[model samples]
Target: MTPPFHSRISGLAARTLQRLRSAVSGRLIDPRNYQPPLPLPGGLSRAQIHDALTAVSIDGSASGELFGYASSDLDRFLYTLAMVPEGAVGKALEIGANPYFNTLLLRQFRPELELTLVNYFGPGSAQGKQTVSFPGFKGVADAVTFQYDNVNIESAALPYPDDSFDYVVFCEVLEHMTHDPLRSMLELKRVLKQGGTMILTTPNAARLENISAFLEGRNMYDPFSAYGPYGRHNREYTRHELHMLMTHCGFEVEASFTGNVHPDIPLGQADASTLNRLIGQVRHREHDLGQYLFTRWANARVASEKLPNWLYRSYPAERMAEGQ
Candidate 1:
């Protein structure tokens, strides 16, 4: 028998209310559902990798909280590892590696790699040795300790001689630079061997969340951090800007794309669907809307050393003119 007309209307209204609640509350994508974009090296399983990374313990320090934050973002770290080329040998430099999540992964998967780490405490930080320990796994000991150097990449020249490293992993550090990111790029180019690769990753400024925020008339800037100026994201780059920066810095762009390393949050399905449909119409914007941007650049030519005017102002006239 068919329901009465009033009863059917009541059921429809209830269903509509439930959908509204879900749209308002939002949904979180389960981290366990993550799949690697590329095949993982060393024939390791995701479960094994998760166990090893989660097992990491940092000694007592102010950075302990920071280490915890890194632990929570396992997906981000794993994607970084996947982006790194396998069979890479020779010295690798990981800038701003204090939390040491990525450092540990590199040591585990790429045992043949001679890895050196660098961290900056602050402007007053001096170059010195500091050790970190992680639990043992295959091809590693029961406990592993790493000693890294303290150096300021933005102000001082890198302590290493030119062409010192075959691979430079400059992940998540570029956005922390308050000024003169080009200077740091030049320093990296100096340290990287000819034809060597530099893997650079940073948050995409044009990400979906930021777009949502702008549409809603909300501020999109990062909050001031207790960890000081370097603690917050000073600036973020879009995919196009990164390509231009690398080209200007004299690196041959090998491979680059944006991908979401973090789990997804509901952006209001209606709004999200509309945005996605619009983005689908534009071919260039399709790949530009991920949580993070990963790029591989090869040191091919002498750096042009020109700072694009679009990215800088209040500079010496000559420098601006040179970029123009």
Candidate 2:
């Protein structure tokens, strides 16, 4: 039945407002056509990487699914590899090295370096071994069985000596630190050689897609996962915040930039351009809008004994003092 005139007018006004919002925000980019901005590293082709990843077999269904997801995000993995310095040598540690996708690539590219892998499963520490088999580039099947230490980085001290590793790959693990991120960073600092390099990568909390999601009134947080809290991203950082954290952790930033590693599925040209222009007007857009922040830092000194007040609160008064 037809409503009253005022009711009909109100409906029309609501529809108009919806359309206006759509026009202002623009449409998202088609997911199928989105391509990665960076190319594969070490002259490796996508097909080779795909074949290698597909050959990987883990024990559990959840692990298999995780590996599959890592396989799909080839660009992200390659971009991470590219950020690692070619000159990096000596002992290298990879934190949270499950599925071992990047570990395989590291072995293929940097065979000279000794590698140690770490993963967290429970509250305490233990040692275990993992064996991964994949078809080599020469069409021959190859297997890698490596020993990995199981320790909760947030709580337990790493099972290593001081200045143990020359390089540490802490990619995509920071956001999963549910309790104490500073503790993990401090532990990493303790193990890394004083002048060694550490490559780290994490999702940018201020990426363009997040901005668009916020504008559209969509929830921006990660959903609960079947794999538990560590399976989901608990905290993300902006480029600036990461730099600040790294500096506070006694690392000197050697190189840092943000880039789109994932497909531009939900971000379109119109919205990106509009936001970019708006962001540019106030300050240089820079690499602030990229999907992920990639950085290489040198271990310079001991990590801060106190947590930065900006990042934490409700702590002991002395522990919450301002950071340098």
Candidate 3:
């Protein structure tokens, strides 16, 4: 039998070889080749965001509560903002504010724009608790308005006046509100000005990783984690599902794209432009593989009458019966 030390060394060698093979076979995407879209002014500079995202811990040496993931968040935020016109957004509200990442970036990038950040977690309250937790507020407390209320996207009415915002940013929060996405969509529409643009980002359920997971008969999510069903991704959306949901919710989809492939995946040794070309071939529908479904939707006066029942429930019951 092999000695324990020899076995350990063999294992390490196998892992190293596997990683090298994966890199060569296109399983591992080089972070350096990731060419994100140009920033639309008032957002993190391209270099700043890219550097932040690519700064991985060598040998897992980095330390912090959210050490590795913070860059991913920044990436999503920048990508979502790319769809918005620079200096076009005036008054804006961002749903599901975690600290002030979105607002802080906006305030710095677009000083002229007024921003209100709201969260369901009260001050001092973490993600799910009803206490009070304001982790990122101390730094930018004076820069913007921060409110803590139990804002349930499924049912609770938004504590905002009608048409309160020129645009809205809903990033990475949709999949969590699994029970009543329609209600949240309507609530978002209510606060948004007519013709206002809504920038939304959510995970792609059909991502290749997820597909592989499903085929392998493994639980994709950690059941023990997250705050209730709302905290975890109860329902992820495919590109088609997202388009239909937005179109049904009285919004016109203006543009769509996929972004932020899993940081660990090596997107081949191709240049950034070449990788982007491959992405374009899928018409951004492969957002699942990329893991983010980035979309821009405009609020409309008359959404399609054939909206789903979940959306119509808040309206007249008769409208539901009439299929209007």
Strongest candidate by TM-score: 2
Tens-place lDDT digits, model 2, residues 126-196: 98887777676446788778788999889888889999999999999999989789889999999999999
Better of 2 and 3 by TM-score: 2
Query: How far does residue 66 in candidate 2 sit from its true spot (Å)?
Result: 4.4
Q: How does each model score on lDDT?
A: 0.71, 0.73, 0.58
Q: In model 2, which runs have C-alpha deviations exceeding 4 angstroms? A: 1-39, 59-67, 267-273
Q: Clashes in each model (backbone N, CA, C under 3 Å)?
A: 0, 0, 13
lDDT of 2 at 142: 81
Per-residue C-alpha lDDT of model 1 across residues 255-287, encoded as one tens digit per residue:
666667655444543354455455446754544
The worst-scoring run of ten residues by lDDT in candidate 3 lies at: 1-10
**Compared with the true structure, what per-residue lDDT tens digits does model 3 show for residues 199-285?**
898887765445445544654663644456656787788877888778777788776655554453332334434343444456522
Q: How many angstroms is residue 249 displaced in model 1 relative to the true structure, after the best TM-score fit?
A: 0.4
lDDT score for candidate 2 against the true structure: 0.73
TM-score ranking, high to low: 2, 1, 3
Please give the TM-score that candidate 3 achieves against the real structure: 0.66
**What C-alpha lDDT, on a 0 to 100 scale, does residue 322 get in candidate 3?**
45
Off by over 4 Å in 3: 1-63, 122-145, 148-150, 264-288, 304-324
